[model samples]
Target chain A: MTNVKVTPLTDLHRASGAKMVEFAGYLMPVSYGSILAEHRAVREQVGIFDVSHMGEFVIRGKGARRLVNDIITNDCSRLAEGALQYSVMCREDGTVVDDLLVYVVRDDQVLLVVNASNIEKDLEHVLTFDRNGADVENVSDECALLAVQGPRCRDVLTSCPLFDDVREQVERTAYYHGFSFTHGGSEILVSRTGYTGELGFEILVPSNLAVEFWEAITQAGRDYGLVPVGLGARDTLRFEASFCLFGHELNDDTSPLEVGLGWVVKLNKERFRGIETLRQEKKNGPKRALVGFELEGRNIARQGYTVLKDGVEIGKVTSGAFSPTMKKSLCMALIERSAKGTEGVYEIAIRGKTATARLTPLPFYRSRAK
Target chain B: MSFENMRFSKEHEWVQFEEGSNLVTTGITDYASGELGDIVYIEFPEVGQELKSMEPMGTIEAVKTVADIYAPLSGVVREVNTVLNDDPGIVNQSPYGEGWFVKIEMSDRSELDGLMEKHEYDRMVGKG
Candidate 1:
């Protein structure tokens, strides 16, 4: 509990009866009530989450695009101003440093949103390319983020009076795009992006105005069934969508190619970190492949649970949960690629006993997000 | 089933003994259920199985974590609440009523003497 950071919305979350927990050095809300209900709120209607704990770094200078392009796996040079690209930064050996969002703000400025836990490590990693002449600054503490997500997300946002000045821009923003607008003399950045498999917008406001913005959005969204969500439902929502969580699916030693995120690795582009290794991996295939599965019954295959084939261990579960939307126990595991076969049954060792599981497609739930 | 006649164990389980018989019903406390969040499944011990005082009897699986349930006293499992198999959330809703875990036919009724009464258990859990 000592040295744990609190976001500006901490008091508000406490007032709403949130169950707070320490995650990645921050005392954040895991849930306000039942995670199932909050999960349903996002899938069926709309929900808002205080995701301010995530790290935000701003890179600026004439060498900004080059420095960013030289570090991440994805091609950011093709991005138009105001566009966002999902990418991963890798070590020299093609293993992940972190997965992040690259926001192209201007020709000379870029914003990188990364996992909260890797702030210091990521900052250090980025500073390695300082000789490229780009100025790297960690702006995580100065920013507060809110993810307004669901099928009805746009409707609730448009109806909020606080966003009256920016309603038009918010409505016209395309998926994976963002725009900066002034609301009541305060700068706000709105992006049509989210980790949840739902139509959503992630709004960024100054930390000092976080409480004001949250209350305003909540007040306007009350009639639209907008519930205040927490990290618990955030994980479940992302898990159901088969999105890769950094610690779970994309650790430092895990290659992007092995985790089904190969699309972000543009080996054909100019040289970047791990280009040689990733190109070799792409040609010869990775040693391991990430896959999803469904347990036969109520049995849950928790993280680090061994995945076996005929009593021999082949892999381990990276993430598992009783899917609130699917009502079935689901898991994502990284196993030896040679052992993969969609038709075969695998056993997941849970608390000494094993549960039978069947291999399924990567994304267990398809999003209704346009 | 009244609180006055019930005794609690340190493991957050409550047990109520029948006045004239050795039959005792046991389940987790409200605080335990609340802390566990949403209980999705429960692995109950089989009927007729003997258990020693404070021995592991079963496990409760919630969304976030799993917890082991211990036998409050020496007994033989007589019955289990099958309703939990279909809707484990009942444990979160009514932890002491229909959500009862097992009915044990006690072998040593005097073991209950070491258990805490309602007030003491409440104080131990910070309610009192």
Candidate 2:
């Protein structure tokens, strides 16, 4: 068996009695106590997630902004300093390489955080740009990342004296925005961004200080209902929010336009790598549209299962699970727009038997706004 | 609990033989359910279907993974817990009571001899 690489916090996860599993080439915590408990903890209070496996790259030098703007589908020029924008890094065919967050730290420096599995490919793609204008460095190994997510996250984090002044700053920062702060005498970057559709922050710190930082936050947030969450609940939470995972919802073959992420793509901007093909796909409409569905029966639809209409196979489920929050089996399917009839009845082939399913609107569950 | 009266299988299934009717009620053990968290779906075999000992009879889909439910004795399925259609979480909540997967009419009474008792099954699972 191939050995999965452990994060710098693996020992801490094990000491906390986390159930470790291989996910995206990293041996990460799947749960600490229970999946449902962790799921609820993040929804109701605050949860700390060891997301250090995510890849981070630093792009610096003159003309760095131009190089970044040329590669990603989103218009980065509109982003002010100290802001973050969600965009899809795509190939020339308009197929997504990965959906990533771009942090424009300064005029000459930008930080791109990508999915763990696509790090090598993303770096390779970024390096293909003319090296004479910009320098790209993969700094994923040097940094550790943690997400303090939920409604109570701000209260839990602001207790740290180092973040006292910055807490006020983060309060004013809107969603998808972030700023830098000093914590424990260490300068760290805190972003008001997360995959779980809740008010949260993603903190980037040095790898050596990760365990100390994690313990400090967990201890301070204990009375406030903060729990250390694992990857299991993280997956379910993101699925409920209809966020795209790299291999499941978004892949090298799936375009942003096909998955209802067209808003992130900037076609009006002068020219990017995938602009022409994306423009054509947008005008003609994608052949297959990714849609959310709720199974009527108890059977859970899984990946690669055929989605049938009137007993004829029309499409296939890409990502599916039992939504812990909604108490319903939910799935995302890529189906031919023609076969997506207005009728609510659809069948999912599960173990050779067809189970009834219905096309629900995207986001099977929504959080109560704070 | 009468330990000698109940028989178990290596797959963590348990069966209690009814004295005169020659029928048996089968369910996965508590240990099995603890390992498979929050069963969301259960596909049970239809009534009247014959099953061989140690053979795959049904499938249980949990929140995280899927496991096969195996038959503990050679028998024909007499009844299934139809309530599982709406409340599959019963498997996680009570694996031995309302979560019983099936009732079977025994094809051979001697099949029980091949299975383990509670003590042996517990020993095999490292809990004895």
Chain A vs. true chain A, TM-score per candidate? 0.98, 0.96
Per-residue lDDT of candidate 2, residues B6-113 (tens digit)? 889999899988678778999898888878866778889999999998999999888788788899988899999999878887877888789889999999999899
True contacts kept of each: 0.33, 0.47
| Model 1 chain A: ten consecutive residues of lowest lDDT | A126-135
lDDT of each: 0.92, 0.86
Candidate 2 CA-lDDT value = 0.86
Worst 10 residues of 2 chain A by lDDT: A361-370
TM-score of each: 0.97, 0.91
| Candidate 2 residue-wise lDDT, A230-258, digit = tens | 99889888888888888888889999998
- Native-referenced DockQ of model 1: 0.63
lDDT, candidate 1, at B14? 95
